[model samples]
Target: MSTTWSAPGRVTLIGDHTDYNAGLSLPFGLDRRTSVTVRRADEPILRVRSDSPGAGPVSVPARVLELPEPPAVDGWAAYPIGMAWALAQAVPGAIGPFEATVTSDVPVGIGVSSSAALEMAVGTALAELFGLDLGPAELAAAGQRAENVAVGAPTGILDQTAVMFARRDHGVLIDFADLARRAVPLGLAAAGLGVLIIDSGTRHEHGTGGYGQRRAECAEATSVLGLTSLRELGVDDLDRVRPRLAPNVFRRVRHVVTENARTARVTELLDAGRAAEIGDLLTASHASMRDDFENSVPAIDAAVAAAVDAGALGARLFGGGFGGACLALVPTDRAEQLAAAITAGVVAGGHPDPVIRLAAAADGPRREPDPG
Candidate 1:
């Protein structure tokens, strides 16, 4: 018998790179998702097939007790394999051999957490097949463990929790300090605002690049400031501690502290239905990431400029930086024009033409009960 499940991808409305620092972030699941279909068998072999953009197919033994001491494989199949491995770790010996097919409309490597969407999709299938009884938070944690331990990506809980907990027409305000999530209302369409996601088309791999390094710098700043995390500092406190930190560490801490406040403001404004007022906050966020965090590339800046010039109310570089995508708050009427201008500008600036995706807030991970 086969069980099918799907999980949506995420877009960070505000708050960038603050998750690992145990700070605040606001994200929403977008309309795109990855779907997985799984069938359990008696054999010891596990097979994974996928149409996930760049991943090929793979097969491995479903041996929970004999998992490789080190993570052995990390291709397209790593996501599902890690899903089964997560189930194995959570409930010993309950994992069974399974065959699964994965497909996604979520663009890979665009900072949309395509990997997390894939993991949660497969994890939900495994949960149903084995009767694991995982809750929303448990499911998110399990997927994060799989991504971190098995996939070797040092990401925090933002992407996984956003995909699992976000809801329709809302942004999930996540406090990573304790994994608490609250779905805040976002009246974008009612307010005549549109979310524009412009893919910079520059590929970034979090594990091998500067993402981990930036995370480490934040930790260093926390150590020097005698705080457990950068979350402890507010925007006012940035000046008090600025002299004590090194230039780079101070900049990193500044970004996190300010971004956390921006998240709170965005949540407040979103709840109040003041969607247009949050545009400057979005642009400020991009500047912090660009100037303070030093993660934005030329293509990212170009996208933001073109988006704003084409009548976007506010545009910022989105994702974990080093080249991913940009988010713009635009008039619903100007969305197509914004897309066209951004594309032309990027290509004219000698960068690859960017693909623009218009997204609305979507519900979190969902599973269908087995009919058999």
Candidate 2:
């Protein structure tokens, strides 16, 4: 039997990089999605193909899927292969010899968690095809393992969990401390507000790059603070901890501490249906990322300023730092005008014109009806 599964990409509104610190984060699944179709194979091999441009097909031996190490495959194929490997470890049997095809509308390289979307899609399809009864949380954990172990990116569970537990018309408040999630009412549509994303087109990989460096720095901060995780340090404790850390390390700690607090405040605003008021908090979060966390790029920073100039209530750089996309909260009626203004402003600043789109909160991953 053949089956299809799909997962949505996610956008973090606040609390970037706080996931590994065991702090809080606010994220929502976007309308964009990645899908996978899987069917049993006659041969004992897993064959994977992608509709992405320039991506070639890959084949892996099903026998090696149970191994602890990731397969030798690289590029986009690693994500699916990693998922299979991860699922094999999680489930109590050998993984499938199946043929799978992948396609996505989720923009790549713009910090929308496209990788997580792909991973979840693959995981869901494999689970169903193999008759493995896995819950959403279990699937999310498998996806995280796929990224962290098989894919070699030291990422937190936020991306996987965000895309799995997200609810339509709501934002998810994830406490990395306990892996607890609460749905916050975004009410964006009810409030006449919408989310606008501007893709900076600058790409970043989570695998052993500056992303790893930041994670290492956070670990160092945790060690210096004598805490298990940075979540143990609240804003009140910052003054005492500041004297113990170096300048840069202290800034990183400060970002996590303040960001956790900001996430809580945003949650309160969202709970009260005050989505519009959370705009300032979004801008503040961007400032913290730019000045404290040191993750914002010049193009993203310029685009954010332009978005505000174009009447966005608040704007901030989205995803892990270095390069990605910027998000703005704007009036729904003015979305087109704001997008045009932000694009024009970015281009005028000598940066490549960004791709802008309006997105709404969307449901999480699930089995999809056959497109046929």
The 0-to-1 C-alpha lDDT of every candidate, in the order given, reads 0.86, 0.90
Considering every candidate listed, which one attains the maximal TM-score?
2
TM-score of 2: 0.98
Instruction: Compose the digit string of candidate 1's lDDT tens values, residues 1-372.
Output: 799899999999998899999899999998998888899867888888887456666777666425644246767676678868877877777778888988789988889889889988988888888888788788888788888888888889899899988799999999988878898999998999889999988988887779988998999998988998888888899889999989999999999989999989989998898998998899999999999999999998999988877778898877788988989999888788889988998888889989897899998878755545
Residue pairs with backbone overlap in model 2: none
lDDT score at residue 34, model 2, on the 0-100 scale:
95
Residue 182 Cα positional deviation in candidate 1, in Å, after optimal superposition? 0.7
TM-scores for every predicted model: 0.96, 0.98
State the lDDT of candidate 2 residue by residue for 156-234, as single tens digits: 8899999999899989999998999988989899899999988998888888578888888999998877899998888
For every candidate in turn, the CA RMSD to the true structure comes to 1.8, 1.0
User: Any residue pairs clashing in model 1, and if so which?
Assistant: none
